[model samples]
Each structure stands twice: as structure tokens, then as C-alpha cells.
Target: MAVADLLALINEVILNWIRLHYFYWANWCGLSTCTTRYLVAMAVADLLALINEVILYWIRLHYFYWSFLAIYPVCSVNDVLRYAATDCSVWFTVAFTFDRFVAICCEKLKTKYCTGKTAAVVLATAGVLFCLKNIPRYFTQKPGTIIDNMPWLCAMVASYYTDPGWVAYDWTDTVLTPLLPFAVILLLNALTVRHIIVASRVRKGLRGESKGENRSDPEMESRRRSMVLLFTISGSFILLWMTVVVDFVYYQITGIGNNLNESQWIFTCVGYLLRNLSCCTNTFIYAVTQSKFREQVKSAVKYPLTSVLRRINKSPS
Candidate 1:
């Protein structure tokens, strides 16, 4: 929990900076407006998820139990929002993956589907759907205790574990989130790799690279850049979430109950640790994969100091 708090604090600061950069200086950045919109949405979603899920819920419950956020109604509402924020973050990544897949593999559809207007519409629609989907979570929570007739600390309703409807909802929710996104991302990446390989071979032949003529294909180069960003972000997501996926499958298969043994507890904790870690990794991925993004960061960092210096020079010292 301490590790999670530290990481969440660092992530909060960095994501806020990244969000500001992407939001205000978006036009000046080299990425397409469509891609820029997705990245900005991702940063916001990640920030909300870290704040609500980790700091507000986990850290506050453990370290600052007296806070009013632990009270009934508010705690339940926070849980719903936390789930929605997390859903938005996961699905937004999947949406961006699909967008890139269209841009790279479906040349005929890319122009229309990969525009800023389409991106906005798609993101807004997904955001609304996920928010609605998580509303039922509010009812599944009961108070951990009642103090002076006031309920405190949200806990799962007793029936949630045994009720058929709630069980189905839990399964559906899990499947809808990391599980479905996991499978979809992997499938899309596989198809993308196959397409790129075939296209490269055909283009190479057309360019006479097969005839001992060495030439640079600008089209392939462009595709390569797009692929780098897509794969790095998606790949990092998959790697980080692998433990959580495996942990889910194991518990389901074994039919484990709440009384987990020590080993099971450790495994679950590690899975959650990695899951939280995923929320912080995309910014670093962008820094490592995109040179233009690095340049934008540098420019954003300089803007503050430059403005202060310019003002100081204008004043009589």
C-alpha cells in the first residue's frame, strides 16, 4: 500500500503535466488531431483512476479513516466513479488501438474514420456507455459500520457473493473490462503485424528491392512510426495486466472464497500492484517511443521559465 501511494503521487504529478501539454499545445504537436484527442482522453482517464481508486479509496481508507469520504452514499458513489474511470481508461486504449489498426491496415477507410470529429464522437459515446454500466455498483455496496446512526466505510453487500444476478453482473463487469480489452488488443495487434509484413513485402517488390536495388520507401517509413507507438503502448498495457488476468482466471477456476490463504493473498496483492502500475506507464512509453512527444515536453517545460524571465527583463530591477 505504501508503494502504491508513492507511485500514485508521482503518477499524479506527471500525468497532470502531460494532460496540460496535450490539452493546450495539442495543435502544435506533430500528431494527428485524432491521435491527440485519444492521448488526452487517456491522460485524463488515468489521472481520475489513480486519484479515485488508489489515493482516495485505498490510501484514505487505510491511512486517513476519519475522512468523510468513507461515509455512506459518498463512498458508494466514489466506487461507481472509480469503476467508470477505470473502464474509460481501459476502453480508451482499446479504441486507440482500433483507430491505429484502421489507419494502418484499412487504407480505404482511414481518411474518414481516423479524423478528429470521428474520434470525439467515438470517445464520447464510449464514455457515456461505461458510466451507465458502472451505476449498478452503487447498490452493491453496504456500510462497513454504523456510527451514531451514520453508515461508514463502504463494503460489499452480503448477497453480492451469492446472489445470482449480482454474480452475473460481477462476471460481466470483469469480462467487459480487462478481459475483453485484453483479448481484443492482442487480436488487433496480431492482425496488424500480419498486414504490415505482407504490405512490406509487396512494396519492396514494387520498389525493385528484390532486384538488388536498395531504396527507401517513405510509405513504409511512415507506417513504421505509427506501429512503434501503437505496439509500445499496447504492449506495456498487456504486460502489466497479465498478472491481474491470470489472477482472475485462477480464482474463477478454483472457486476460491473470501477466506484466502497466505499464498493466495500474496498473489492477489501482486496482481493489484501490477494493475495500479499500469496507470503510470503510458507517459513513460510516450517519452521512450515518440521523439516529437519528447520535443513537446521540452518546449512545455521551457515555456514557464521563459515567460518569467521575459517579464523580469521587462521590469526595472
Candidate 2:
């Protein structure tokens, strides 16, 4: 677990730093401003998720046993913030998917809906809504332990399991997150793929490819690049979150809260592990799918060593 924490911490910090710089400062990646904003938003959300979900939780749980954050009200607030970050990270991917779907399939509407202004508005609206939605989560926590007249750690209030309101909220929260995002991304990607296939055939016919005239179709090439970027990012997200999606269904159907058997316990833990891992994967996806992104990453990597060498050469030795 310590190693896992260290790796996650390192990955989130380093990769997101690189991603932020590449997406924000460099236009070499050839992505539109709207797409850049979505990527930046996702990176920021992933960093916050790592800080709240992994770093802060780790300190409270293991290293700093009596940390104030583990206390009742503080713990509840932490839980709320964590959920908000997770929701933002998950939904940003959905936003990016929908943006791509519009650009690829709905050409007429794309000009209006897929601008930087629209991206900002959509992200702000979603962020505020999710933050507000998760406020009720703060009430669902209780002290996990009482020691020397002090409450420490957080546990779900018993009523969260039994009360109708809390139960319904729980279901809604789960559905609003990975489950709904999962379905929506899959549907959007499916439609996008179908559109690409039909469009490709039409394009080849119009270009005289059926009569054996070979030519470079710049339009199709552009669409292929967009499809590559879209599919890699969304595909990584779906694959990583698949376990969590399944575990949610299992938990709801079985209603097995505390008495999970060995296999079930492991399964639940693995789902959580993968969910945390999802926060660190998009930078890799970008590197894999975008050649310009790879060039930028390599330059970013070499800049430090290059700077040091330049400094040594200029020194009076």
C-alpha cells in the first residue's frame, strides 16, 4: 500500500504537470482550443482527486493516526470534496466525448456548440452542479471511533444503509457517476464510429477510389486523427472504470454491506484500486495517440538536463 501510494502520488504530480504545460502553453499538439480546455479541466480534476482520495486519505488512515481531518465534521467535509472531485474527473471525460461526437457527427451544430466559450460554460455548469449535489454526502458520515472524548475517523452513518432518503441518494450518486458516464460514453463512441464508417465509404466513392484512383484525402486524415484521440482517451476511461461499474451492480443487488466474503472483499478493493488508477491514465493516453504530444513530452523531459548543461558551459570554470 505504501508503494502504491508513492507511485500514484508520483504519477499524478509529474504527469499532470507535463500535461498542463503541453495543453495550456503549447499549440503544437494541433488540438482546438475547445478540446484543450476539456483536457486541462480533466487534468486539474484528476490532480484534485488524487490529493483528496489518495494523499489526504492515506495520511489520515495510516501515517497520521490522530489527524484532525479524521474527526467527524472535517471527515464529512473531506468526503464531500472527494466525491466532488471524482465527479468532476468522471464527467469531464463525458464532456470531452460529447464534444468530439458533435465535431465528428453533427457538423452544422459543431460550430456553435464546440467553441472554447461553450466548453467553459459546460464545464462550469457541471462543476457547480456536482459540487452542490454532493453536499448531502456530508451528512451521511459519523465517527468511526471514539477515544478520550475525541471522535476519530469516519464511517457511514447506519441510517445511510437503511433510511429511504439516504438509500435513494446513494443510488442516485452511483448512477450519476461511472454508471451513467459509462453508458453515455459508449453510446457516443458507437455513434461516432458508425458515422465515421459511413462517411469513409462515401468519401472514398466521391474521391474516385472505386475506380482505382489513389489520393491523399486530407479531410479523412483529419477525421482519423480526431477519432484516434477520442477513442484512446475514452477507451482507457471505460476499461479502467469497468470494474467499479460491475462492483456497484453487485453491491446493490446483493445488499451485502459488511459481510463480504474473501473473494467479494478482494473484488471490491480491486474496483477501488482501478478507479484511483484512472486518474493517472489520460496523460499516457495523450502521449500514445498524439504524435505532437509525444514530441512536446520529450522536449519537456529534456529541458531540465539541457538547462543544467547550458549553466555549466556558461560558468567560469
Candidate 3:
């Protein structure tokens, strides 16, 4: 069964159970409440998917079969998690892109308009939209469907591979969602680059000195670093998504290129593993490439460590 179907099935089962035994929980949990729970659940799912992918990749690289059975459950859960994570990721990416757009384009109005309250509202709105968009699939189930026929270990949504609605969903997911953010980022990057170049030239002209003499200007250096980081992340985003697009196209055009019947389990598992890895790669890139992010992470860890050290130093030895 495809990941989406498995997720839909799992979501259906969970929702049904919640409705049956936990009526109070359901009543008290509004859309925002459910969405928050879903987002956290999706993050956990993505983490599991990452681990499963790493293990599967290791096994495949080493040509191991002994661990296959043991890893099956991990792989299955990974798929369901992947579906949930993908949905959460889409919403999060939209939020991130919008945040960047506002930060870059509306610098003057940011303090007044883009406060934490505004961000929270935007996130809540996105969560609602994402849930509503995907809610239809939960009700559209059939007996012996793709998800039902899968291993009986756990309930999962079946893949609606042949469903016409899926094609529409694919367009929305693969084309519209990423492309919109990408376009906005590209435009902002271009404008920022152009502004920096113009400012550098003007500063050099006003200095009554050769451009080479002022090449080490602090402002110019900062701008250069900022541009480099922006381009690096933008490039990574494009590359990561391009791989997904290529994979989707290949699947649609060639109808499972690698003989699924012969290599059914391994091929499906590996493909999913790679896709999940691609999604997780962004977090690493941000940590490694962005100086501001690195500093924040350092401070986050160092503050606690420093307090502990101070307490130890003040205590009787």
C-alpha cells in the first residue's frame, strides 16, 4: 500500500477510536488542538522515518536479509509517519517561506505587523487549511483497498494510487505548494542581491577611491555573507525538491521503473527511505550553514550548561 493510503487508514482508525471512547477529548479539542497534536505526531513520525531510512540504507548497502523481517514494522510505521509528516511539512514550509518573505520585503512594517501574535494567527490558519484539505481522504475508503491488503500488523490508510483525486492532490502538492514558495524566495533573493550590488557601487563611488580599495567594507562583507547563506539554502531547497519531482515523474510515466514485483519490498522501502532523508536534510543544512542559527543553538545549550557549572563551583567541594 502507498504511504498516503496507509495514513488515511490509520487516521480513520484513530479518529474512530477517539470518537468512540474519548468523546470528551474530541469535543474539547477544536481544530487548532487537533492540528497541534497532528503536527507533533508528524514530527515524531518523521524522526522514525529518518531512523528507518538510515537502517534500510545500511542494510541495502551491505546486502543483508537477516534484518529485513525485524525492520519491516519500522518500515511500515515509517510509511504512515511519512504521509503525516509530508502534510505537516507542506504547511510548515509555507509558513517558513511566508516568514522569509515578510522579513525580507517588509522590513519597515515588521515590528508593527509581524509580531508573535501575527505569526501564531498565520500558523493556526495554515493548520486549519491543511487539515481541511486532507480530511476528505479519511472518509473515502473501500474494503480490500490498498491499505487493507497490506500486512495486518497495524491499521493504516491505503494508497489511492489510481484515484483521480490523487492526481489533483499531486499537482497541488508537487507543483503548486513548492513552486509558490520557491518563486517568492527567488524574487526576494534577486531583489536583495540587486540592492546590495547597487549599494556597494554607490559606496565605492562616494569614497573617491578605487573599488578595490573599499572591497573590505564591513557592510559589503556582511551583505556578501548574507547573500551566500540565502543562496545556499535556496539552492538546497530547489535540489531537494527537484529529486522528488523527478521521482514522481518517473513513477507516473514509467509505472514503477524497477520491477516492483521482483523487488517489491526492498525497492518500496528504499525509495521511501531516500525521500524521508531528503526531507530531513534541510534541518542539518540550516544548522551547518547558517551562522545565526548556529549561534542560537550554541546559546540554547550553553546557557543550561553554564548554570550547572556555576552551581557546582559555588557548592562546597
Please list the Cα RMSD from the true structure of every candidate, rounded to 1 decimal place: 6.8, 6.3, 10.9
Among the numbered candidates, top lDDT falls to 1
Worst 10 residues of 2 by lDDT: 17-26
Name the weakest run of 10 consecutive residues (lDDT summed) in model 3. 23-32
lDDT (Cα atoms) of all candidates against the true structure: 0.86, 0.85, 0.52
Q: Which stretches of candidate 2 lie over 4 Å from their true place?
A: 1-19, 22-26, 211-214, 296-317
TM-score of candidate 3 against the unseen true structure: 0.54
- Estimate TM-scores for all models: 0.85, 0.85, 0.54
Model 3 lDDT tens row, 1-317: 55467558656855664353233222332212423333233333344345434443345436643333224454444443334445555445445544544544466875665455665576667655655665554333332223334422223234545557765675665555456666766777777777677777788888666745645578667556546645665666666565555556666787653345655545555655555665576545533554655676788989998999999999998
Score candidate 2 by lDDT.
Answer: 0.85
Q: Candidate 3, after superposition: displacement of residue 119 in Å?
A: 2.5
Error of 3 at 101 (Å): 3.9
Model 1 lDDT tens row, 29-77: 5678899888888777877788888887889978988787788898899
RMSD of 1: 6.8
Q: Give candidate 1's TM-score.
A: 0.85
